[model samples]
Target: MFRFEKYNIADWFSFYRILAVPLLLAFVWYGERTLFTWFLLVSYSTDAIDGFLARKLKIVSARGSQLDSVGDQITLIMGLIGLIVFEIAFMKANYGLILLAFIPYILQMIIAFVIYGKTTAFHTYLAKTSALLQGVFILWLLFFGPVYWLFYTMIIIGILETIEEISLIYMYPHWVKDVKGIFWALKDDRRTIRKKTVKKNGV
Candidate 1:
């Protein structure tokens, strides 16, 4: 049902992330840490490239937004797997904080699904920064080892972003494709438009 009218270059880049999951998994299975790190870096890079391309080309659409969100989630999961597999000691040391950070995020996901059925694709500015930090931290750890300062910063921003996303989900009556953040969401008229579309499309 999530058909795209046409796939743009940005969509293709996102699609690459989805399609790369198996390759990434294979790397993990084979314990190819170096290869996996390089590939994960590429997958993370695509996230930035797709967003930039979509904005530059003005090819953004609900379908593209959904695709990008899916790609982002997939890449994040794969990267996390890499982190656990390769940096077991670090993850063990910081497992408590990681679990703590995930609590609100997990609840946020539940809240979104219960209210909206699917995850919100708000793509807030805070989320972008959090994602950038995640990628940087993962790559930095894999390449040069963990930096506690960066790890702590990433956790803080990530939790903050999750809170912002949850707030946006409740602020809007229906799923929104994009939002700047809580501040802009305050005055975002796009909510009305998205609500109408959701009602019409039953999405």
Candidate 2:
């Protein structure tokens, strides 16, 4: 009944990862703690599976890359939201650190959209490690409750990530050249506009 081999394994894993989000939500909302934990583990495991399949099978399509990014962000966001809601409803206290860390990420997302039209690809090793750390740390907070030192660590990492993205934006000209398609697109658009202006001027 399953035809996994016919499709890219990474794509299939990414799809499953996205699908798990709603399942996780339902489990958390219904107060099924055991089930929610299992779902979280499964969802997190898919991260490794998808990365491995992409590297091993060499099927890293742009679509797969986009899907992987969406899947990751959704997973992390939902997990944090769940923690915040749980804390507020049960503990009657603020999740101040999570809220603060979110500020730079929100700014980064906005800058990415305004500057590049999409969130930049997970391009550097530091960026990837930061993401993984955030995800694992958030999940740990959810399952075990927040620890003061860990929250501080997350805040520091978030600051570093913000700096990294800002640096990337300022250095885009140097970086885009390595990504041939983005380079070509920028060059072609400039050439097209110049040609149009020259034609209009009878030059």
Candidate 3:
């Protein structure tokens, strides 16, 4: 996964978030709320930066998509850990909703991996929105306090995004990357094209 020879600028940006995970955890371990929140902010910023650079430079690839997804999952898990440790009261208050939203997401991962042998890179608009809301909600809670509306919005968007991903998995029947959403998936050539072979006349 850490192929220095093949990594582009955008991939490195995604890698930054992954590398920051331990630092974020260290801050959490030390009970450095301010430091943890600030470092976590950097991680979220890279999430946006990597995606923008990938699109602007036309350097997107399946590997890049997978790297970005892994970075995202790790960052989010770390962020949740930070939240649980630093904001124990808030997390306890909302544990049920958090767990409820996570179940479908976990199930989606299981189904996708079982069928596609890897994580889905759908990158659908809904997924992007969900990530955005999640980052915002988590950061807001850490920096300020709990905002019920934002929390609720993030939960709803997350569930919807996970459902869309599961649906796309069934639609493609194989791995694909950078899909915009369900509408685009319906028209994706990857889903429609069939393999063909041409034999030499001598054969």
Candidate 1: regions farther than 4 A off: 1-5, 192-203
Per-residue C-alpha lDDT of model 1 across residues 117-176, encoded as one tens digit per residue: 887788988999999999999999999999989999999999999989888988897677
* Best by the TM-score measure: 3
Candidate 3 residue lDDT tens string, 63-161: 999999988988889889988998999888888999989999999999988998988888899999999999999999999998899999999999989
Candidate 2 ranges beyond 4 A from true positions? 1-7, 89-94, 173-203
Between prediction 2 and prediction 3, the one with superior lDDT is 3
lDDT of 2 by residue, 1-203 (tens): 86766568788787887888788888778877657766776777787788788879888766677677677777777666566555554324544655566788888888777876776554445556666777777667667766667667767777776667666654462213112233344454544675577779998
The collision pairs in model 1 are: none
> How far is each candidate from the true structure, as Cα RMSD in Å?
3.4, 6.5, 3.9
Query: Candidate 2: deviation at residue 113, Å?
Result: 1.6
The regions of model 3 sitting more than 4 angstroms off are 1-3, 194-203
* Displacement of the residue 112 alpha carbon in candidate 3, Å: 1.7
The lDDT, on a scale of 0 to 1, for candidate 3 is 0.89
Q: Ten consecutive residues with minimal summed lDDT in candidate 3?
A: 194-203
